[model samples]
Target: MDIDLTAARVVLLGRPGCHLCDLARDVVQQVVAETGDSFAEAVVDEDPVLLERYAEQIPVTFVDGRQHDYWRVDPVRLRRALAR
Candidate 1:
């Protein structure tokens, strides 16, 4: 499905083979599913800029293009973000 640009974004940034990243993705997916919000995934290892910026902070989540969460996803905060 195509995402609406105006909608809030749930960005999951992580690398392969990271268990924590996988868990973070799952939490993000759950939040998006509950809120029916737009979602995007960024592979830090593939993007030079993201790699440098989030090299040590994989599993980061961004809401509306702003850094929202890192290391873990907060479902309550995510839902509230979507509501706004």
Candidate 2:
């Protein structure tokens, strides 16, 4: 399925085999579930632009199409952002 990341309320940028990405996914999933928000995951390695812009920031999280956090996701902060 083709997911429009821009339209998603939350976007997760990361590559496979990333431990941090795994953790971030879990937190994002939990927060979005509670907030009734939706999210999309984009593998940085799959897109050159995403890789270039966020290669060093795997596990990056974007809320409302704006960069929100990286390396780690704080559920409280994410919930707060979604509430905005």
Worst 10 residues of 2 by lDDT: 1-10
Query: Candidate 2 regions off by >4 Å?
Result: 1-4
lDDT of 1 at 58: 73
lDDT tens readout by residue for model 2, 1-84: 233457689999888899999999999988888888988998888777777778998889999889999999988899888989
Report the lDDT of model 1 for residue 56. 88
Per-model lDDT = 0.76, 0.87
Q: In model 2, how large is the Cα lDDT of residue 82?
A: 90
lDDT of prediction 2: 0.87
Q: Distance from true position, residue 46, model 1, in Å?
A: 1.3
TM-score of each: 0.83, 0.90
Look at candidate 1 and give me any clashing residue pairs: none
Top-scoring candidate (TM-score): 2
Candidate 1 residue 6 C-alpha distance from true site, Å: 9.3
